[model samples]
Target: IMRWNKNIRLSCAYLFRIKYNGKYLLVKGNRIDQYQPIGGVYKYYASFNELKTKLEIEDEEEINFYEEGDLRQITKGKYLEKFLDWFDTKKNREVTVIRELIEELHIGEISIEQLIKSMQIEYLKTVKEEIKFSKHFQVDELKIFNIYEVRIPDETLAEIINNDKYSLVEAGEINKLCFMKKGLSTKISETSKYII
Candidate 1:
């Protein structure tokens, strides 16, 4: 079951899928009739550790599949809580707009080579780095202007979109679960300009 303080906002999940032609993303196809990722938000718990534990359990009960961890294998930086605090500006309220892009959607391990192949762009140089302009300003950067590639399998992407196995539920209330995936676009837009 999921639980959260009344003040805490729900986390959002966004799933990206490969195109049917096996090239580029299927931007127009997957958007809900309402538009965007087919998932919604649920309230957050008191602590990330607690939330992580509950997430694994919910994944099993809802999808019959258990994910090993709550946070994705992105390049490490500040704790998620800090990011939430910074974004929401309400210290008492924990609001995390989590983007759940599936690595399996691309098939094979996530590698620069795979991205290059999938993007279908010739490269002469590639760069992966943790951009840190200052102690507080930091971000994960993956550049493939040249000399790098990555391939994302279409079948893998389809499996995620077609399965309909995952549920976006609250951490404290299981009943909070529902099949809603619309609205709040301004709040959860893909671009970072809106985050501020």
Candidate 2:
């Protein structure tokens, strides 16, 4: 069963352990040197009613019709406190994961469908609640890093890397993926342990 952290904050993020053929997919962006899983920070939005009022959305049905892109645009410049909400609900978390898999990872619909079918939630690390202060903002984060692994065909895996904004790294070069050790301490410490 999937666990939802009621205290999820905007500073919190998700990362996938997309495994295929003894290798895991780690991504490095054009700007960043560190290679990490394909995921991003979760954004909060207003309640359906509040969003409707703020966006001047009329039809009650249309109020809940916003897609991921639409939601981002509509919520721009809005205070998180005024609209912040958690994936406290199971359905909300599932939807967020689906969206993240598609949007952030660039996983195709067919591949994503297959991947979801094989996903199993495994608890990897749990950091106790603490106040994190940055240069611009501060947040109390009770971060829980979870791992979800799925196997895919070699061809499909190649396609994912070639077609997406990510580059592939060999399983032997696990150290390139910075957060791997932080999250998957024991399971990924030795390449032999994870590659197989």
Candidate 3:
């Protein structure tokens, strides 16, 4: 059970880094109302219910109805390394990035069916953020981000970036948590730096 004095978040996320014209593409976040990388939290499969129950993992209630079973959850701090170990096995979890990309980019089935050949996806880096007190959520956040570099054709990228829901930040302008708007000095998203 989550206690009032201590709250620990153990969650994993995968993010995509797409670049065009020296600018990286960032999409508006659903929960925080800020620009972030085109990605979401990993999800545990139904078969993991045994462990979920054992761990007393609670379903995410902050997001919409569809995000009921994502891999994001809060628990005791003692389960920190154990959670990452279970996640490294890559079993009983959503491992593919296709689902998130299709959801965030709104790609058609035809376009997605042929994406593998036209798109070059590779693991970029993994960032492990130490448990720290968050003033916004009023809890200690422990997060791991599996960042991937997704390379697509310039034409398709331009088309996707045209959407108002997306923002462009230059490579140099990216700070630890925020980035300046393309050709401007406006900053957005404190957590977007993880994608870099």
Candidate 4:
């Protein structure tokens, strides 16, 4: 899933090249419950060389569910071009951006790129305990890295450490993807940052 504010018309797709059992696995999803591809957002390493390393680690950690095989990206270059346009211009809401990803990149069924994007989106939705919430729920928290103050804590962050390793998810606050997009008027202001 991808997130761009309401002002930007952009889409994000998780691209994956996998060969398992001689058959490729593709993931797809929508607002409704269903299976989607697996993968996370890339904050750095926009180039293919750098992205490949990020993809490798993610594949080993998450995409490994798919049959074993070589990994590659069928969707090359301009991977974030469409989304960047909106992200650079309008400053859209993170949730809206992810929703747009659900609407645009979901082709026929699920794919690696879609899956990674979806996973990254889900990871970012997690909130910290200090944040207050009207309701209590359990969700896994995903960490984000700021290039300026990059450091690794005891826990492994969902975010990529090296730009050469993975692309970073644009949303850092983790507040944007907190609420479930059940409808158009879904208000997340009251929700705790910790709720995913």
Model number with the top TM-score: 3
Taking the tens digit of each residue's C-alpha lDDT, what string does model 1 give over 52-161? 44333222122222233322212223233443343244332223222223232333445445444444322222222223232211323211111112234554444434
**Model 4 error, position 63 (Å):** 24
Which lDDT tens digits does candidate 2 get at residues 28-52?
5434445566654444444454654
Report the candidate with higher TM-score, 2 versus 3: 3
lDDT of each: 0.28, 0.43, 0.74, 0.27
Strongest candidate by lDDT: 3
When 2 and 4 are scored with lDDT, the better candidate is 2
Off by over 4 Å in 2: 1-10, 30-33, 43-45, 48-96, 105-131, 135-144, 170-196
**lDDT per residue, candidate 3, 15-98, as tens digits?**
899888878888877766677788878988898898777766666566552366788788665565566788899988988887
lDDT digits (tens) for residues 1-196 of candidate 4: 2311111111122223221223222222323232222332332233334543532223222342222221212221233344234333423222222433344334444553634443432223322123122121221222221111112221222222222222122122224522223343222222212221
lDDT accuracy of residue 39 in candidate 2: 51
> Which residue pairs show collisions in model 2?
none
